[model samples]
Target: MNARIRGIFEDAGVRGWMHAVSLDEPEASVELDADAVVPMASVYKLPLLAGFCRLVDLGELDPRERVTLEPSARTAGPTGLSAFADPVTLSLRDLALSMATVSDNASADALLDIVGLRRLAEILESFGLRRTWVRRGTAANLRDLQRRTGVDDPDAALAVLADNDRTDPVGVYEAANASAASARDLTLLLRRLWAGELLSASQTEFVKTTMHRQVFLNRLASGFPHDGVRVAGKTGTFGALRHEAGVVTLPGGAAFAIAVFTHAARGDFRQPRVDAAIGEAARVAVDVLR
Candidate 1:
């Protein structure tokens, strides 16, 4: 698998770097700049969702707490949750579904509003990740833009962002200047969740179920299907970065965590090099562990 994945990196033009690790089998691995911090993109949403579920475990917020999705909460992106649905209210749990299952930008954005970015950053820190950050957009770019206006509005930055690109939280703000983590850290996260350790047992189950319901239909899911292999993962994409991190339970009951991150700038995501690299890495992970 390592040789295959290595070949894939070369064949696919994985530009700046690549890295992968296994949770169930510690000895299985591959890397390039394994310690480097690149843009995380949507992968940050995983930690954010886990942190929110953690809050629920503490009884601080009800998973089913009802909230209304006003028009302002919507954003343009690939999502069934944020789409043409009329003004509707849903429980926090349902909102989480949108954020995870369908990659709904509005749902993810609104969840950030509810969970707060500081808490998410702290959650990763508590989980022993040294390089992960969930920075707020306002903290990232607001003060300079707000100069002379003598006004501070957190919502102002979020409103104009992508409606115009920038943020105060997770709401489509270019991830606040490159939030990132190593494949090793991401694998650790998946391993923990697979073991029902990230949140309370029930919430952990919810997280797992949400992962199983992922709608992307590509990446590791399509590439690594082997009869009963169950994939539960999160993928992130941005300029120069494409990543997928998750746990796979093989047909033989062996489970492993695999994460692949690349910094390919020239290749369109659909390019053979990109898919071949990702597919090859996952294929290697399966062979080593399963």
Candidate 2:
């Protein structure tokens, strides 16, 4: 099974790290380099979401509080308020919704500001996720990328990233310097999230619903196309790195938590084969666990 999954990743021009476990019985599992720390990319938003919910549960934050984000002040990104030309106003909870559903960088950075980096680290520690940590938000990360590439523009930095010969950008691909986690740690987070042990019922449901509504379906969701098989995942992408970690529920009520992180051989912006392989490898691992 391991060999087969490796072949699938290799065929897609990527090397992968994966972990799939029965949510109800975590001991029943499948793994390959699951301990390897990799860049979290947008997947870091998962922990950010948890921190947001935690603050709400603690009465430290009001989810319905409105925030006005000016276009000039927002983070740079391809989606959400980051792409909009005009200022946008939304409730904290609605911002969280945008962050989860669209992997919106602007929304996420706003949430990060509300939930400080130190507090977020404490939340992760509370969850016993020692291997996971978000060092900074998207805006800081992009600035770091630009500085490393000696480019004034984020787009030029991205162009430099496309060159395979360039060094790994610190806050983008280097696990130690970026938002990063191991596959096993990610699966554990999903397991705990599904268990509803740390969060209130309403917040848990809110997160689950937001995750289920995520717009991108080319990675993990691609593996399970059946109407009866429900998949809720968060994907991450940076240069050659692509990842998705989520929970999959079968029609029979059996559930599994899986995390697949890959580093592709090429840095092309659109690597459909690598995306499909993420799903395929996940399906294979889940099959073995089943």
Candidate 3:
């Protein structure tokens, strides 16, 4: 089964790491380099969201507390409050929603500021997710990229990382310098999440609902496009890496928590084959677990 999954990844021009376990029967699983730590990219928001919801449940933070994000204070990104010219005010819960559904960096960093990075690390440690580490939010990551490349412009620094001739000084593709996680750890987190062990019932539902509403579905959702088969996933991308980790629920009620992380052989911006391979590999893993 591992060999078959690897073949799918190779055919798609990427190296893959995956872990899938039956939520209904946790004993059943499939893994391929699932324990190796790799960069989390936007998927770092997963644990961030968890910590946010946990705080809300604990009453340490109010979900409905509204805050206005000035343009200068917001992190630049392609979506959400970052794209808005005027100052935008929203409740903390709505910010979390935007972060999860659209991978909004501005919303994520804002939430990170509210929920300290140290607290997130503490939360993961408490959960016994030792191999998963979220070192910083997206803004910090981009800043490091700029500093590493000695480029003032974020986009130019990103392009330098994309250049095959240059070795990435920021090491964004590796586990150490950025937020990183093992597939096993991520799947375990998801298992507990789906089991309502991570947050209050309402908060768990909020996280699940937010993830289910993710706008980008070409990766994991492509494999489970059949009617009534719902996929609640979060995708991560950085340079050559592309990943999606989430729970897949079948129409018959069987569910699996799967995490598929890949690094492509090439650095092309658009790799539809790699994206589809994520879904296809996930389908295969889920089928085996089923």
Candidate 4:
């Protein structure tokens, strides 16, 4: 790791790990505590997307199938269909797209219902990702927050998080049956996906193209702003944790699968410093690999 990169993370008072490997030369890479397990937050959606694609490839599920869901039946979140007050109907492919492009909670849970949690795990195991798993959906995470804080509402639970009171919010965040993964494991998953080892060609393209449409670009994308370098990433944010994992493709046909995960020393939801650190850390790792 670069000294400046180490300083960037150290100064932010956050625990971070990064792993980057080039698609053209998988053996060439950089790692900093890459094996450390951290809360994946929405980063779990990447694997869920893959699992959904696998089902599509196997003819077990149809991406064109339409499903309807009401707000009450879906997970509570502030984006996409989750934020709508009325019932919304969409194709399974569009739902997966919403989950990847906007990190839509409702879309994720709806797709999770179709893909099944056990099937998602089976897909990851087939890819050799032993340390990654999603215990439940986003709605279950919200319920866990309510249970831990003794608050029955999502806004109240968030207020609890913002106030930074009631012992060990981080502990509660980690203890919740949310998804989890190690940085190394996430990077490897991306590697396999890019190497044409995870899904069929068309299915893999669907996953990659959806990732390219992600609306959040403050983390991994912030690091690489060059004209021809394209970044397709998914970000995860909850409590003191912020993570972004995806593949960064350069103009020369070189691509690096990178995963950056962080937990702030101070549990502040508005901490921009930690977010910037994530970008800087990933920038350093990508530079080294490049």
| Best lDDT among the predictions, by candidate number | 3
Candidate 4 lDDT tens digits, 52-122:
99999999999999999987788888898988999998899999999999999999999999999888889
Q: Against the unseen true structure, what C-alpha lDDT does each candidate score?
A: 0.66, 0.89, 0.90, 0.84
lDDT by residue (tens digit), candidate 1, 19-129: 455556667666655666666667777877788888898888899899887765565444655575677789998888888887776677778888888877877778777
Residue range with the least summed lDDT across 10 consecutive positions in model 3:
165-174
Per-residue error (Å), model 1, residue 273 = 4.6
**What is the Cα root-mean-square deviation between model 1 and the actual structure?**
6.2
Task: Note each model's CA RMSD in angstroms.
Answer: 6.2, 1.4, 1.3, 1.7
Candidate 1, which segments miss by more than 4 Å at Cα? 1-3, 16-20, 136-176, 267-273
Once fitted onto the true fold, the runs of candidate 4 whose alpha carbons sit more than 4 angstroms away are: 2-4, 164-166
Residue pairs clashing, model 2: none
TM-scores of the candidates are: 0.80, 0.97, 0.96, 0.95
Clashes of 1: 4
lDDT of 3 by residue, 1-290 (tens): 99899999989989899999999888889999989998989999999999899989889999999989999988888788888899999999999999999999899999999999898888888777989999988899888878877999877877876777767664556678889999999999999999999899999999999999999889988998896989999999877889999989999989999999999877766789999999999999988988
Clashes of each: 4, 0, 0, 0
* Model 4: lowest-lDDT 10 consecutive positions: 167-176
Which portions of model 2 show Cα errors greater than 4 Å? 164-172
